[model samples]
Target: MNDNILNTDREELVARLIDRPESFTDKQLEQILADDECRALYDTAIQVMHSIEPKLETNVEAEWNRFSMLHSRYRRSQRKWWKVAAMLAVVLMSGLAYATIQHMKQETWSEQKATESIVSDDTTTKTTENKQDTMQVQTSIAQPRTFENTSLDLLVGVLAEHYGMRVQVMNDEAGQLRLYYEWNPALSIEQVVDQLNTFEKVNITVNDHTLTIE
Candidate 1:
């Protein structure tokens, strides 16, 4: 047979193996059993299919009997190949399944870490606000509160809440560093946001009750 024709037949055989392996005719099964390439393709297809969607129950004895009956000469020159193919199918399916589970676990862990970080920061911000309030009560009214080495996010949050405004960090290019400056309670929300805009590349916009940093 021509190489092109053989390849076409092998491709069709592999497709049928994936979609409907049980429907293979006795002649087709015999061809697959005789050809090393076809057997390899069959093993690979079985491995992939089993990995993606595994059956809940499988009868080993029944399946082996059915496969034996499909080709009467299954034991002639292909018995060793059949055994090797079955073993390879099992190992490949197990490996793929393990890899998929590991990937899912990694993604889940990443999401959990992100959630913990956000919650921790929010809790810390609330605690810091409470401590500042306590310190203000003990200190003189003549002294103005100053912010130094404060996270930009925390500073923006404090300003937004105090001025009854909404603060938005619009882009990744925006500053994400600590601030070191004196806080003036008398400054308007726009002036405060302008003070917070320390980065040269960032653009800060204050419109009515909203402040945006990009």
Candidate 2:
């Protein structure tokens, strides 16, 4: 016979024997025992059924209770897996949220520091520029003007005006100094006095606001 037909027959024999073993007649047992495969299947089924329950419950309610217990345990196992998966999802989302917040905070802090540094640099630069402007103004006020092709007596008069002093020529040699070369206009009154002392046969003295040249 085909495998399907054989399996069907084996299922029927196992079910009938498990339900009522004493219902089968002696003639039917003899016929089933004549086939070795059927006899072995029957013997194994009887052993399994007896091992399961010595006095098997015959009511539908007893079978339903057994099935419900097995199904409940299976459902509990499935719910446990779902619970674990839900907790893992929650943890992963929390981690992502924390990382995003930290990144945003770090970016904000960096930008704020950069802005502060730029403002500080600008303030320092403006302060330095103002100081330089003030120094330049003071230098312009104290600066002397250039002289070109000027005589000694006239230069002495100009120097008197430049130094805010009186010019005096005590000897004829004092009026003979003629300057042809360029002189730096930034020279101080003390420096000019020292230069005037280098002339031949000249004696110069500066006392407060009077210039005496001999």
Candidate 3:
């Protein structure tokens, strides 16, 4: 016979033996044991079937319980991670809100300070202007004295005699008498001028009012 026919026959025989091993007739047993190769193949098939048989019902239950416990632990671990993630999100949001509030407060305070500084500067400027106006008003109210022609000549003569100075009288743009003096030593000019300005008979003021030298 061909190899394919022989293998098919052997497989069919093994299947029948596995299906009804106790019902095997003596003739079937003799056929299976007639060749050493056939006997070895039958033994191997029977051993394989026994090895592959389903486990006991109790063992199956135990395996199922172990799988359930392992699955439950895995689910618990996943839930814990989820909770940690949620807490982290909440904390981050709270921190963000606090930071935002702090920044706004700082900005508000800065703006307020800037406004206060501006107001203070404006007040200071106004006070300074007021003080200057008061001083000017006081100066405007002061009276000046007049000088006689003879007193003026006497004053010039005194300046020439005591300080070795020469005095010149000229007319200003407003047709008023302007007194000028020259001294021999240039350094003595300021001193001579100051002394002449103190003379009681000379009018030393140059504005609209007369200032009598005293």
**What is the per-residue lDDT of model 2 for residues 97-132, given as tens digits with 9 covering 90 to 100?**
897699667656755775777877655655665697
Against the hidden true structure, what lDDT does model 3 obtain? 0.53
In order of appearance, the predictions have TM-scores of 0.31, 0.31, 0.20
Q: Write the per-residue lDDT of candidate 1 for residues 49-84, one digit (tens) a residue.
A: 779885669899977764444334235686688789
lDDT of 3 by residue, 1-214 (tens): 2323234467666666667766566666676666566677788877887899888667877676645432343455577787897899799889978976996676567657757788775566556656976886555433222222223445444544444545444422212322333333333435544645543234343222222232
Candidate 2 total steric clashes: 0
lDDT for model 2: 0.65
Extract clashing residue pairs from model 1. Answer: none
User: How large is the C-alpha RMSD of every model relative to the true structure?
Assistant: 30.5, 52.2, 52.5
Comparing candidate 2 with candidate 3, which one achieves the higher lDDT? 2
Candidate 1: Cα lDDT at 69: 40
**Which sections of candidate 2 miss by over 4 Å?**
1-146, 181-185
lDDT of each: 0.65, 0.65, 0.53
Badly placed stretches (over 4 Å) of model 1 are 1-143, 173-175, 198-202
